[model samples]
Target: MATSKDGVKLDKSTPESVWKQILSAEEYHILRQKGTERAGTGIYNKFYEDGVYKCAGCGTPLYKSETKFNSGCGWPAFYDEIPGAVERHVDNTYGMRRVEITCANCGGHLGHVFEGEGFPTPTNQRHCVNSVSVKFEPKQ
Candidate 1:
């Protein structure tokens, strides 16, 4: 397996069959197929601990626990990313226009970002992320 710049193992080049075998059904759905976990059902929805969140698909570090907050959006929410860890794209699916967030290294679909919500953050932005798209690592 190849590793990304942040030292995360990447399986983006792996075949779909291999991915299905390696990942859980929910993880494969959200991370590889660009699907979304249901509202309020994500493991990290109410989780708050000191750690880092890594991409489930490629293991790339994406967000710090400090950046996480309870937005009550029924998913893990972040005010910011670990700079350069993610990329943004214009999503026009489902008859809506939104910014899609993805892992910078493996291009795994993370979730979406919204602004102008007046969150108590420097950027005043909300990065609504799917719990299945990430794995949390507590600080040692």
Candidate 2:
């Protein structure tokens, strides 16, 4: 296991077969297959807590609670991710150009990121995350 910049352990769990054992069907769909949950149905959609949001696949800390904000985009929205915790890629899978975000460690899909939406955030970006892709750890 390799550790990330923040000292979060980055397990090299890869390939579909390996994840099928650790994640449930729902989690595997979103994190492994790069699928998205229905809007407004994620557990973190309306959740506002002071904690760290970690990648469900590799337990790498991805987002800080303070970066979370309600964008009313029907998903968990954050303005920023923990430094070096997430990776972005130009995604054109569905014929729509979007930047897809994934865990830097395990390469698990988190969600897409949108920029310049004119939100009241410092970064003016929305990191739309799938609740199934992450787990929350409340700040102690």
Candidate 3:
């Protein structure tokens, strides 16, 4: 494992080797290829426990339990992210305007962030993340 600048542990190996060692074909397809999983099928969809959500590829703390909210979007949604923990890029794929979110330390695709969610929170942001991109560590 390689620790990135933000202390996220990313697989330092080549993409092929990392693909072979760290992920299955399906996982690779969804995470590496930027494919979307069927909504409501992800393990994190209903996770309401208090915990820190880390990047699956690189164990960087991304979201805190306090920031999580039910966006009813079938994905694990968060109103905010750990400061400086993620990076956003403009995505022009599929002919849709989207903001691509990635682990700031490792450049791994986590998901996308959207605005105008109309949540009561001041940020009014929704970070719709893929379950496979995150691992939860329950708070004690």
Winner by lDDT: 2
Model 1 agreement with the true structure over 29-80: per-residue lDDT tens digits: 8888899989999999999999999988778899999999999899999999
Candidate 2 lDDT over 73-108, as tens digits, reads: 999999999999999999988789999999988999
Instruction: Give the candidate order by descending lDDT.
Output: 2, 1, 3
| C-alpha RMSD for every candidate | 3.3, 3.8, 3.6
lDDT of each: 0.88, 0.90, 0.81
Flag clash pairs in model 3.
none
Q: What lDDT is reached at residue 14 by model 3? A: 34
Clashing pairs in 2: none
- TM-score for all predictions? 0.89, 0.91, 0.86
lDDT of 1: 0.88
Model 1 ranges off by over 4 Å: 1-12
- Across residues 1-140, which tens digit of lDDT does each residue of candidate 3 receive? 45545553465343545554666666666657777778999999889999899887667899999998888999999988999998899999989999999878666678899998688876999999999888899998
Worst 10 residues of 1 by lDDT: 1-10
Task: Give per-candidate clash totals.
Answer: 0, 0, 0
With candidate 1 superimposed using the best TM-score fit, by how many Å does residue 109's alpha carbon deviate from the native?
A: 1.0
**Of 1 and 3, the candidate ranking higher by TM-score:** 1
